[model samples]
Target chain A: MRELSITTEACDTGGCPVRVVRVSGYIDAHSFPRFEREILTLVNQGNNRLLLDLRNATYICSTALGLLMSVFRQVRHNAGDLVIAGMSEKIANIFNLLGISKLIQAFPDEEEALRCLAAAEAS
Target chain B: MTTRRRDLALMVPGEAEYLCLVRDLVTTVARKAGFPDCRIGEIEIAVDEACANIIEHAYGRRPPGEPHVGKPQAIAVRLALFPDRIEVRIRDRGRCFPPEMASSLDIAEFAASGRRRGIGSYIIRSFVDEVHHSYRPGRGNELTLVKYLAKGVPGG
Candidate 1:
């Protein structure tokens, strides 16, 4: 199994300060710590508006999903949002089955998620 | 008729890397056993949850120390590939999950709650074909998960 790699960057969405974290490879027990660390760093830095691009993500375990929910809670409590974007149908189904869709917002693409986050922040 | 069989065991320190290794191995084994892409994903998720439970409950975050108190190896994952099914057995020498905890977990309830942490065992049961647990008085606990592939698949 390959190591899970998460890349973070501040995406310039026509003036909205949104951070995009691209998670690739497998997100099982092994890579969850790194995932938690990066999300925590983003939250601690006060960058709460997040768009997680999972277009390249091959797998995500319940542990990873749990961490995402924890981060979402932290962000929401701080008046920010964590959005998931570009999840594969299979992965999306897992999220849906876990009822994550009800707790966090999801979009089909990064651009749409960014737009939604931007609009929400402006309101 | 008997199917081809492959069995191996891994003794992993309670570290994140080992968890990934287990997932990889399980996925590969499932694929080799002719599981469809969708089923492979299911097996991967189930295996991860089982292993994560062991790491968190058995080893308690940090790696086990020298002279390993109870068992020289705190955790071990065993994989057995049969013609029609793949069985993953995770063994840990830690406090067993209280019978109450095991009995109270209802998959339907957890699915409705959507709370992240408590759904592991439930999810494992829902995704796999069969899930069994045994706590031998002196031998510690073992969680066995089996996924049976559909007939048209391949390995068998």
Candidate 2:
């Protein structure tokens, strides 16, 4: 079975501590469990400021997008923030088409997403 | 059991538009089978999830191509209506699902995470009354999903 590689790190943003997770792989039905596990682990740890770097994702389906929205709702309920960054145009367009961008903040890069999340938390 | 019903199959391509087509077809079929709006919506979501999995994972990221030796030009979604239930089978000649990978998933973890990310099969199982998977050595993979339409079920 092909594995999805997910790495999380603490971002040094000036405001709240943001956890940036970079995911690289096919985020389809097969590999979605791994992706969900990593995100839930971080969320359970109170790492609400999430920056998903999807630049390396080759494919994403509606199921994957639905899962992201579920996570976003969970974080929001906990009064935390979730952000996505570095998504390819195709992935970004998918998010937009699904109206996910309206629910969660998306940025062009990790730094910008982290900065924005920090700024929002500070204000 | 002698009630005659219609069956239709559409080749779903990897393109995203096919998702909508499948959704519309499933909704129409469910409605014709006497399912209410909410039930039809649930069935549509389940079918969409299944077709999306076929397009994205079964076929990988390959673009639309001619029907090849082992690869079909589109994923075939077959629907059969019975007197009291509906059976939908999705067949694909692409990559078969690995048992180990399919078995490793934890549905509780998915529920806890509240992430709808990878629970296509789970969704299918929950929405439908029965779900089955089989693979013939030379025939490829087949997923059979059945939903019973009982009277007074709020949507039947």
Candidate 3:
């Protein structure tokens, strides 16, 4: 398959705007710049409530993780939030081991994460 | 009968595009060595981080007056499988990574700092049981990482 592919979708749930970004393949140092660019472009365009879908993503290097955290901080700064969905157990375990799970919430699938984020935004 | 130990070696150019090959080799061998899926995943990341570091911190950090600006470098990775653990040694002829900078910052603090680098060291440490880095004047820089199998895990 490809080294990395990122696709985004705009969704409005309960009057809350959320963008679902689906990533597949490996996110190593080579592809991280593109990943960062895509996220930053969306954020700059005011699409900051991001639900990152990693169901098909096979791997994520630490630098990419760091960039995710950096982007998360930026989203929060803009009064928005970033959450994860449909990540493999391996990725989830890695996040937990690195203390990233504590800062970001992950759900089993995109629907659940979108629902929760919408609820959280509505409240 | 005792399980035979296996030693595997690979040499890849120090470039980001070849990292997937390294990860695939390490994980495939780890699985055949009887490592559980989770442990295999950890090994994959550790080895990937080491090679990626070689690509970035080692070869990427060249001096201003360096002559071989675009010269290709290679990373040598050796994987030895024992009855109780797996050991990985990655060697490169580039600058030695700073030992003092190997520690991980709090993820939140790191994110807030807006820094995109430095987390590779943390992932390497967190995934492997032991880590060692040594540099030789004529040889190169070698990083060794070990991850012990859990009790009762079958030998390779």
- Best by the TM-score measure: 3
lDDT of each: 0.74, 0.68, 0.82
Candidate 1, pairs of clashing residues: none
**What tens digits encode model 2's per-residue C-alpha lDDT throughout B1-156?**
458577877777554445666665777888899986555655665676777666667666544342435544477888998878888888877578631223234444544567665545544655566668888776777888788787322111
Q: Which of the numbered candidates is closest to the native, going by highest lDDT?
A: 3
Residues B1-156 of candidate 3: C-alpha lDDT, one tens digit per residue: 536499999988788777888888888888888888777888898888888777777888434234455657899989998888888889999886743335555877787788988877766766778788899876779999888887322112
Model 2: per-residue Cα lDDT at residue B33: 91
Q: How well is candidate 1 docked (DockQ)?
A: 0.39
Off by over 4 Å in 1: A77-79, A119-123, B1-9, B63-74, B98-116, B151-156
Q: Which stretches of candidate 3 lie over 4 Å from their true place?
A: B1-4, B61-71, B98-104, B151-156
C-alpha DockQ for predicted model 3: 0.55
What is candidate 2's CA lDDT for residue B129?
66
Q: After superposition, how far is residue B139 of candidate 3 from its true place, in Å?
A: 1.5
Q: Which CAPRI quality tier does the interface of model 2 achieve?
A: incorrect
Scored against the true structure, residue B88 in model 1 reaches a CA lDDT of 89
Q: Scored by Cα lDDT, where does model 1 land? A: 0.74
